[model samples]
Target: MSGVQDQLEIKFRLTDGSDIGPKSFPAATSVATLKESILAQWPKEKVSGPMTVKDVKLISAGKILENNRTVGECRSPLCDIPGGVTTMHVVVQPPALEKGIGIVQDIAQTI
Candidate 1:
């Protein structure tokens, strides 16, 4: 016999100042799973290492997102879009650029 399934709606904020919202999926999903789904939508962004839904902030009605809580760790599966949801927030931190005197010297020689 088939049983009713619980669904959840997730929203993401991109660094580009855009917002993705109203993404619905099955409940009881893990943070890793949700990250995968988000990546599918935004292939340009890479999410690795310590970055995760924990960095995502929920700005909507019926719920309040806490600084300590992450989307992956939240008990509420359903996310509502009340307002002020900016897709501009980045889920992953960008990699740092390498620094060295050799690189600058090479550029100077080329000039």
Candidate 2:
């Protein structure tokens, strides 16, 4: 156990008030890694479109974490991070819908 550190447990809070989990990851894990894990374990019933890392944003301690940054980099910013499970908010921004769909609405209103 030369340089071994305790794993960090993170739980995600979604927009609908649903939570993902307190998944464990090495302290050195990157934000990108966390996003990938979420996509892999995302509830099918909740998501419909492609769930990519770009669609996921992780916020902790009121700060939006950088994808390239490590979880350890964020540890100090959060209060009692090591003392208990670190809670982060996961925001999934819906993709913009196509513009053509609006044409139907315009035609209906004209009639």
Candidate 3:
């Protein structure tokens, strides 16, 4: 007899200290899908500038996660120890230098 693997309810803790969600998905869900969800739920008010997928990264248990991997594939030690639910970390990278650092220039003008 075969039984289904349980879906995971994953919450995200942002590097900016914002909490995103406890979104649920199947264990086989792709990392690309997860990132899309995060991008959707990200707080627009919290943004200092424009955001992009390339600026977002997900980490678990101190390890950077790859977009092609599944959540289950990247499950961290914390996920197993925390009574079953998984919490991932989100890091927002600085936008590419091509973006011109307009926010920084604006801040300098204010100072």
Candidate 4:
């Protein structure tokens, strides 16, 4: 309540043209936290949803925001219009295959 002015309205636009929120968050909130929120609210009907925060990527102003950066830090002048909600694109990247396992097996066969 004290820092209501510091609260930013954010909406996550998913790849399927669905949205997760237009919710208010403190400026100090981290990108990782936003991902966790998205994971929690992911639509049950949607297929291939992100399984963890690591699978989610937040993009704003054509830049992929780092997990360590706070929401305030990721905001750009063009995207942070006063009293306007910021829309960030959400991308879910599936975990990579385990290539190391195959490589180790090959080395063992060679030995």
Candidate 5:
């Protein structure tokens, strides 16, 4: 019974309004760990899903969860509801293109 209280039921709501899970994670799990899990379970058929954990962001209770924060620490009062599954929005923003890749440099002495 005590162990059950230590688990958090979370569902990842994707941009398309589809959900990935209502999975249970240990309260001690870090937000970064959740991102990894989300990346792994992301639908392969989705053309533009996150390619890495670094590209995944988890938003709960209208706030973005910090990577270093534990699930327990990120929980809001809404999460205190008994036996309710918390829904976190998943946003996949891929890393920007490498810097200086598109710039054309011309080194010519004015003549």
Candidate 6:
């Protein structure tokens, strides 16, 4: 069988606190690519650039989320407990929305 056929299925959560269904991807998928996929799912919501993944935390089953570490960097000892490789939790911080110039002008006029 091909490597892709043996790839594992995992679930990822969006920054908006939404649960994304399990997806099949190669084990070699980078944390950065995962972040991009999450953002793409929610096009309407504002999301920070690549750097935002630095703040994401991957939570495994039973294990609590403590420090901020990307899945790629998280390994044994830190989160290598048994039965911890299947499920993962990612914390994504949505991008901030700025008021339009016209809106600001209108508010200023009202003041």
Best-fitting candidate, measured by lDDT?
A: 4
- What 10-residue stretch in candidate 5 is worst by lDDT? 102-111
Each prediction's whole-model lDDT (CA): 0.47, 0.78, 0.73, 0.90, 0.86, 0.53
Candidate 5 regions off by >4 Å? 97-111
TM-score of 1: 0.42
TM-score of each: 0.42, 0.75, 0.72, 0.84, 0.83, 0.44
For each candidate, how many residue pairs have backbone atoms clashing (under 3 Å)? 7, 0, 0, 0, 0, 1
Clashing pairs in 3: none
RMSD of 2: 5.2
- Residue pairs with backbone atoms closer than 3 Å in model 4 (clashes): none
Candidate 3, 14-108: lDDT as tens digits: 87676877776777788778878888887878855326667777788878888888877877654564335577888777766646788779889
Per-residue lDDT for 20-83 in model 2, tens only?
Answer: 8977788899999999988888888975533689878899888899999998887765364444
Measured on C-alpha atoms, candidate 4 has an lDDT of: 0.90
lDDT of 1: 0.47
Q: Which stretches of candidate 3 lie over 4 Å from their true place?
A: 1-4, 81-83, 97-111
In Å, residue 88's CA in model 6 sits off its true spot by: 1.9
The sequence of per-residue lDDT tens digits that candidate 4 reaches over residues 1-111 is 558658899999999898999999999999999999999999999988998898898999999999999998988997688789999999998765336677888999999
Q: Best to worst by TM-score, what's the order?
A: 4, 5, 2, 3, 6, 1
Q: Considering only N, C-alpha and C atoms within 3 Å, which residue pairs clash in candidate 2? A: none
- What is the Cα-based lDDT of residue 3 in candidate 6? 61
Q: For residues 1-111, could you state the per-residue lDDT of candidate 5 as single tens digits?
A: 979878999999999999999999999999999999998898888988888888888999999999999999998985556578999999988665422333322223322
lDDT of 5 at 22: 90
Off by over 4 Å in 1: 1-5, 43-73, 76-90, 97-111
